[model samples]
Target: MPSAPIKAMIMAAGRGERMRPLTDNTPKPLLKVRGKPLIDWHAEALARGGFTDLVVNTAWLGEQIENHFGQQSQTPPSIAYSREGLDFGGALETAGGIARALPLLGDVFWLLAGDVFVPGFEFTQAAVDRFAAGGKLAHLWLVPNPAHNPKGDFGLGADGLALNLPKDSAEPRFTYSTIGLYRRELFEAMPFGNPQGLKAPLAPLLRAAMDNGRVSAQLYPGPWTDVGTPARLDELNQASTTY
Candidate 1:
């Protein structure tokens, strides 16, 4: 049987309070990195990965996001928007946002953060085949912890399951790379319109899946930066130029 087409959702509705001034007028995803809008890199990456349908949720000066890339006919993956009006303020955290966009997200799709900068990482046909065969609810990309987040996010065991790190354990924790493939069923029970983030809903499901050996995680050695603050954004810009 032919594998299901890969779809993608770029989460881009945050006010970017940490990246003030620069985001005062423009949304964080619209912020320039290496002279290009941050989201542009993600859009191009997804298209290159063979994703044809793209859904982006926007708020907080969302008009700019729509104006620039709303109808990007030139891009391989056609882009669409799920506009959350000003009354909604900004992003509905993460899980809530995904829940709100379920109509557009099909069965299994990649969910990526808008501000993170990741280059040259594309989904492989073999990987997609494995994902389809395993019937897994989600597959995540984990990276080594950075200086800003030394504690990291989760633990990857030898069995390829993602386990929550012990609060008192001193072992190195692996950080979530903000790139993941998820099944819509995982978020089926989540309540929408609330600001609950992805963690609240995903953590339990991940833990359950880990116990049952359903979740899969891969180590990503490529360059990945969480461009949340101005300092990190500047660092990414500098790195792009120097390297």
Candidate 2:
């Protein structure tokens, strides 16, 4: 018999402060790019890759999201929601939201932000298999630093490990694509990730892991856009249909 499909989590709880008026009522994940809800692109891609069990953590007008995907076809991934806004009274940040959704996920799972536009990304089982075999706590996909973030978030070492470089370091760095495969130990082994609700950011945990060489990463030379601003959204819509 075939193995069970891998589980994936799409982080959709961000308030989209940058998008402002557009996100005033609708959540960032529901914003459209190429005439489709940003999160749908991710869901379709993941489903095509055999990741049919999906968990979405939502806040900031999250009810719309729940209603939007209500009774979606089985061809798309099945969604189990982590209603952060209702349960925590607000968004729980990244790490905290993941922790809240931990009960719905598996030992190893795929993670990505719902607002990013990477239409070309393929969430393949081969990639999951490779990550599972690597024994690393997390495997991240890094992209060339975008125009808005020239400084970048993390450095990629020659050994395929993520580097926690100093801010003043003059090394080449890349922005995290918000796409990754994570081992449960990365969150559970830490003090956080409890289902009881602990609000925290994810960068510190990743940085600490990078320091210990437990995080691996690779450069993704695909089309990607962090659709954070209205201008960026407009740009994507006006640009290529190829994306």
Candidate 3:
């Protein structure tokens, strides 16, 4: 079967509390890595991959994001914003924000965190075709555990299924790269306007899919950094000079 057209969502709504003082005024995504805003790197990657429609959700210091990108420009994807009000404050966690922006995302889309810096991964047309044909709820990019996140997020079997880490497993783990494609069905029961996190709601669904041989993941080997703190930001900035 032919795959549906692709669109992407950049999750940029976090308050970046750990990145405080800096984030006290500028949103994490708006902060510069090297010389460009953090979100610019991902936006350029998406556009290069031929994804045109992009949705970016914002809350803390959102006006900056809107002002910097405006409606759309020639160099980046045509961007749209799903503004989360201050009354709710902070972000709507990953799942809730996706749920709230379903209309913009439609049935399927790619989800990526705004704060992470990666040296671009291989997103082949074959993979996109497989995702569109399989009808799986989500497909994630997994990387070998980095020093900063040793415990890791999900466990992958030889069969390509991604299982939630067992409570007692002591083996090496693979960290989620904060990038993936998601189908709308995964958020059918997720509630909006609350402090719900993505893990609690999506883990079970991912686990069940893994057990049933549905969920899939691709092991990515490349430079990946989560610039959540000042230290990591500095590290990525230094690393960016060479890349």
What lDDT is reached at residue 119 by model 1?
75
lDDT of 2 at 136: 92
Q: Give model 2 RMSD, 1 decimal.
A: 1.8
Q: Under the 3 Å rule for N, CA and C atoms, how many clashes does model 2 have?
A: 0
List the candidate 3 regions with Cα displacement exceeding 4 Å.
1-4, 71-76, 191-212
Q: Identify the candidate with maximal TM-score.
A: 2
Sorting all predicted structures by lDDT, with the top scorer first, yields 2, 1, 3
C-alpha lDDT of candidate 3 relative to the true structure = 0.77
- Range of the 10 consecutive residues with the lowest summed lDDT in candidate 2: 188-197
Candidate 2 is scored at a TM of 0.94
lDDT of 1 at 85: 49
User: Residue-pair clashes per candidate, as listed?
Assistant: 0, 0, 0
Clash pairs, candidate 2, are none
User: How good is model 3 by TM-score?
Assistant: 0.88
After superposition, candidate 2 runs with Cα above 4 Å error: 1-3, 71-75, 189-196
TM-score, each model?
0.88, 0.94, 0.88
Comparing 2 with 3 on TM-score, the higher-scoring candidate is 2
